[model samples]
Target: MENMPMPKTRKPNAQWDANATKIFNEICVEQVLANNKPQGCLNNKGYANLISQFNERTGRNYTRVQMKNRWDALKADFTTWKTLLLSASGLGIDPKTGTIAASDDWWEEKINVMPLCKKFRFAPLDNDEDVEIMFSGASYTNTNAVAPGAREGSAGNGNGNGNGNCNDKDNGSDDVQEVYPSPAEKQPVKRGAAYKSPKKGKKNFRDM
Candidate 1:
């Protein structure tokens, strides 16, 4: 009889402590808002910077690969939490309650209000407007791969998607909203607002 090859076992991911997870989420939100990038946007350079900052702030050493892996896991969990919350909210059920009426025990056990709220400071459940902005920006895609020609201020002219407006000038309308926390906070906080884009103006092709 031919010898059968043994099944390969994958190593389990390192568990991130509560503090590490909190700091990582804060860093992600801050970087996204400050750079006017996207949510969950962490490039290689950004990852290195985050590692340095994490070490400086917490005095803990975490490699880039480790941070990236942790981020991936956290993001997946966060996404699941958001989906469940949205579904529950749609049915007029408060997710903070003891049990989610539309969900199973697994979801009920996995969905914790404090962590979900803390992780997604700008979650839609807390603020409906934030969700609108998130959908409008649609920056959830890989932000590092932004096209060279897709510079800021050329909003409606890039790739026919009309979503590249990222200037600082404000439009004279109340539609734009600011979701980032105050500088004093230095961390993510729950608030309802959209990621403000540049004022709408005549498109300048040169800037593209």
Candidate 2:
């Protein structure tokens, strides 16, 4: 019930922790597998289930508005990540690490062009699989596997609105699938360009 927004507050200064976020994304992915998405969104029932599961797993009492806010925040960051994937140049995906690898100069230039992408310089999104499950759309446009009617520099930006496809019913279930490598697995490499010896960590879950 994104449009229904209620409960404008949370436990005073309460925030999500790493494990909680992991559990939350896991639930979202489960919901997607269950086909609970309608109109490219998890319907009221799906969100309700999410709330229940998230609270149960994390022991936090985040309300609808809080959950919705987090959902929106994650979507926005994913959109930005996709945007960088499509718009950046002189960057390569590290096969071993699954992170976008580039040099200091490349990172500098890219960050200057899109500061929102700065975080990606170090790590990748933690639950990108779950993110796509909930918000896959034209906003996820990419070069090799582009979405319909989407082209380069078209991954949800000011020039266009990235609307999701409407399909299936509301609510869903989950597993923990990290699309990109976690920081723990990363081994620092010499800061030279090319996909050689790339940094494995995200612009990791810290920014997610």
Candidate 3:
């Protein structure tokens, strides 16, 4: 009989706690906003930086595969959460808990169709903005990539985006609307009592 080849042992997955997950999400959000994401995915250099930042912040020695796994998981979570958000648009989010304001029955019904959504119902749904930026195609795709000439500027910022200075300037607003006093607040211009000006060549003499 032919000898059977032995199966390779599987590597254990690195489980991230809440703090680590939060840190990872925050790093991903920052990178996405910095335009490190192209076509809804991080470029090679961007991914490296993301890994470095995530490991630094969490003090964990996670491999690239682990980070990528978490990234994929987050993307899936965002998709599920978004669908839930649209379906339950009328439901309010609790300010204190950050969870959706829905009855148990509603969640039960939704979870049957979206089993992945079960985690969100019980867990505090935080980082709404970060997840939107990191996972949403619409958000990341809108950002323009670094122009050929703008590479130096991006390199200086080290975020791999176009014109690093422009991002902050954009957030500050380009077209600042000047606020003028209301008509009621305007003061009448002060002028000398309606005295006619002297003729062009003649000057008015003061009373002796």
Model 2: CA > 4 A from native: 1-10, 94-98, 138-208
- Model 2: ten consecutive residues of lowest lDDT: 166-175
Q: Which pairs clash inside model 1?
A: none
Where in model 1 is the C-alpha error above 4 Å?
A: 1-15, 36-40, 93-137, 140-208
Task: Write model 1 residue lDDT over 89-141, tens digit each, in one string.
Answer: 43333233322333334333444643453333322232223222222223322
lDDT of 2: 0.56
User: Which of candidates 1 and 3 is the stronger one according to lDDT?
Assistant: 3
Tell me the lDDT of model 1 at 135.
24
Pick the winner on TM-score between candidates 1 and 3: 3
Instruction: Evaluate all candidate structures by whole-model CA lDDT and list the values in order.
Output: 0.41, 0.56, 0.56
Model 3, runs deviating above 4 Å:
1-12, 139-208
- lDDT of candidate 3 at residue 140, scale 0 to 100: 41
